[model samples]
Target: MGAVSKEPTRFTVEANASGAARYALGDRADFADVERGLIARFDEIKNERGETVLDASTFSFIRQGEDAPAGVDASLWRQSQLVIQLGLYKVVDHLFQVRGNGANLTIVDAPEGLVVIDCMEGVEMAAQAMRLFREHVNDKPVVAVIYTHTHFDHYGGVKAVVDEADVESGEVALVGPGTVESFNKYALGENVIVGNAMSRRASYTFEALIPHGVSGAVTQGIGPGGGSHFTTTYIAPNDSITATGETRTFGGWEFEFLYAPDTEAPEEMHIWIPAINAVTCAENANHTMHNIQTLRGARTRDARNFARYLDETLVRWGDRVEVHFGPHTWPVWGNANVVAFLESQRDLYKYMHDQTLRLANQGYHPIEIAEMVQLPDAIGKKWFNRYYHGSLHHNVRAVFAKELGTWDGDPASIWPLPPAENARRYVSLLGRDAILAEGTRAISEGDYRWAVQILHHLVFADPADAQAKELQADAYEQLGYQQEAPQWRGIFLTAAQELREGAATEGGLNTASSETILAMPMDQLFDFAAIHVVGERAADVDLRIGIVVNDTDERWTAWVRDGVMNARPQESQNVQATITGPKQAVVAVLLDPSRAGDLVSSGVLTIDGDESVLASYGSVLEDFDPHFNLVTP
Candidate 1:
């Protein structure tokens, strides 16, 4: 999925923001040397494509205001200020980091060469970061690249940093944990549904849809928001770190891995460089409170596991660490400071996990628990511990929902009316005028939440209702202004913009790139095909087809029976005729209609199966609309 264009809108700062900004500025951000190192290390850095990656223009918003503007929280604005401080920074002797270049890329100087830890989201960005590292830090070549997790932000820009030819020639090693499996599952499996939804929601989370200005996109709280204008590609890992304490020496630099799976990411690991006395927390511990459940939907992250891993990291190496850093944001240094940082982060996730369950067992609904749960004064009061990315309220609800499914013991909610029907009934009963009056009162009383809640009925009841839409947009703007979390602010602001103007006109998702689709393992491709099969259309059809990948010497049989699609390795020859082709060609036939004629003409794909069966299979494949409306039904 990609970004949608939005016109910049102007908003005025509220009275409360003034005090909040003063308080935020006064907070002791004890990393003076780190801030100094983020000064302009280079004028500009570009990728092979001549794309500007690390430049001043993208983050020009840093100089836009001296204080928090309207429709933005002051604490968040303070975080944004730190977040936008981009440049190559030296943590210790030979340990350097490229921050604010998409995602932070760490450079470890090894005996033979530099070992890059976690490439960023795009080639352009990662390449530029490396360029800065080379010119200012070291000119040594990258002998190895370590991906801490499965997230694209951590590993997508491999080609920019190191030559694939080097990796192919066994000169440079590509290392990660659960790299291939996690990438295939998350990036390709039902991506048409999941990826599209994520892209849309992520636009809000990263604030990619909004322009950067006084009243527009500000900060992602982790780093500057980055969802647009980046080329993404995947590189498979040749070396896997299977277990915790797995020690590996890259170019004679010894490093130990902490196999921290299912913390912030599904497959994540932390690296300890005993030589430098620093631990790379990967995304497990970032500057801000990370999502137990990100706004962009996925399997809810394990809060308990997340907390325990941090605790374990401290127990294993807390005393030895002098500095700690991650894929995003600056590093925290000093043995005492680093330990405190780790402890605070550990308690942050654990507190939410423990307290959420405590509240849930007391017969409280998820929504009720969200409101009731609050971070302790120690954790909540700290500037670093504040919810800039992850909100305590939403995370508490996520914990409740994770344990108990969405079904509360209430029967009325089990079969609630769809939005439009429900809204019509609500408007009829409450009366449209009455609802509007109440919404207006709520707005007057500075209760933007109530105004948004009640006015939503009027707008949905009658989508063409101009007055309701206007009022709702106004309320959303106010709510957006009040929010401390960047995602909440961006989401509310985007909704307000959509209401005032209309949904974005541009941006489309390229769900499967040629490289990613072609590189996908045959089993994974078949598994993905099974997911995209339209069950309703295949309810009456019982069909089996064999896919023979000549290039990979693999054959898989897939059957759509009783409205379910099942696939497995071809065990016996007792099947319908086989469609033989190269792996990529067969995948293209299934997914990319644009490539059909080319593949057929080139004789890369040929089917011996009944032509009707192939046609039927094609007909049952579902194509999702990427630009589905989020604010509206």
Candidate 2:
């Protein structure tokens, strides 16, 4: 009773029947030239029973070193191979996506045990989701864990599925929403300051450290949440659901919740499954068109409240869904293709909020309606491609802040000045050979986002032009090879491989630990000091200072007005230190200004009102130096 058609051959995966690992991978190896270019780009948009179907056996390949040993260094480090073919879904049986970008992980077997939802990214994918649930559902013992969102590939593999004697000896239950102030700033706000500034374009946009073959790096065929960390930390949620259509029914799985604050995530939830009609759309109905600001920056979503939570989650579970599942990819069965894939991902977030307000009501701002908004033909011939994780110039500035708000209405574009002294007086009035010949004629008219804004002002007006920094690193590696947004193809191919290689000198930025900065929370350490708090050196010091911890009794009061670096709860006092143990013993005495009094003499710190006023307020705190440099020198 199932001979349906049009792509989607019922459920993918079926390839690599070893037979001598297919004659020990021959066809000019980089693993047979990336599986013969993903079988000739899925035979140019497949559909004849989608040819040999999915073709991704089990999955996990690494070669820029996984401590070289598999099959006697399989061709001894073939230029650091990496393919991570994601797919782990048992959702409803010891439930697992257990490592995402191949989504939907359920794990609810009951009879008083197991509860997980999303958790992908190692402990070998939570030991391959406990060996595919003790060989097909029920080998019991897990009890609880439900971090539906606050990404890092959905709860960085909770110590590879429960430990520290099962969450500090309570035996599971963990859970979500405001999860301990979202896991205390979730690994220093996105892998220590926006994934070392969007992982220098996420290692050439998930080529996992560069592979320009077939237009450079590609695993973001969407599905497999990535932020890299395995034992990162996330067991908070000793149960909390917060409003919007919440329901429970634990173990035996009834779920049905919705809350999902600030859309696609910022404290999220979505589950629904009145007995496996399945919904779970947690990265808010994925299939592409996510992210609003994210260029390693945050706090800016609401594309009209993400199209009114998918037009009220398709009027509350559009006829009890049929199958949706996600955390990254895979899973979307029938029921009219899950209500036309949640009404085309809810009209692709209402056509990026009605064509960025029909070209900002024709006045066009927000980077000229994000350089004239596109994506029609019903969300651009859906393959759910944005290559992986939201793009379209951050959803036309999330529809010009949903019709102009966070002040892009302009006062000379709201007091702008310091994008490196407005890129050194616009390269001293377009000089450096007329902004490197209008950034090499806007990268030979492919216009790569205006040739990455005229090669970021000729690499900030000549940071010693090595031929205008190697022709703006070959126009940011051909706009990170026509990006389909894996963070805008790793931020224009990690700013053209750091203007042809530069940053990352010295150290400190593979990321996480002082137990991930004593696990973040005084509201994500004031949202990671509102992203590296300098706010004009905390508004050139009006500074308040009072703080206390004495090991988590917690006290806060750090204000620094007008320029903005606020912190609350002092009531009234100049009090500067009632200090304590961990929060990296006060970020190792406030993020290093030559390790204050040698970290209060290495006893992790115990301060006073004036250890030179916590060393003149931790020298205006802001050490985000994740191996610096976004573009060139």
Give the least accurate 10-residue stretch of model 2, judged by summed lDDT: 1-10
- lDDT against the true structure, each candidate: 0.75, 0.56
Model 1, residue pairs in steric clash:
none
Q: Residues 1-633, candidate 2: write the lDDT tens digits.
A: 011101111111011122123222342323332232121111111112433212332123442434322211122122223234333344333334433333434565655667677666434455555665666545777777777767655665576677756666755667676545554354346665555565444444443444323333334445322323334444555666777677776665667777767766667777775666677668777656677665445556776666677667778987777666666544566578778877887777777777888878777777777767777766655545232566776678766875577677667868888676787788887677787788778766656567677767766766777777766666665545444355555555555555665654642224344445456566555555556656676676665655565566677776656666667755346654455545656655545535657666877766665556655556676665545665653
Candidate 1 — what's its lDDT?
0.75
* Weakest 10 consecutive residues of candidate 1 by summed lDDT: 1-10
Candidate No. with top lDDT: 1
State the displacement of the C-alpha of residue 616, model 1, in Å, after optimal TM-score superposition: 1.8
lDDT of 1 at 510: 43
TM-score, per-candidate, Cα-based: 0.92, 0.32
lDDT of 1 by residue, 145-194 (tens): 99888777777678889888788787898888765666456544533336
The deviation in Å at residue 444 for candidate 2 is 10
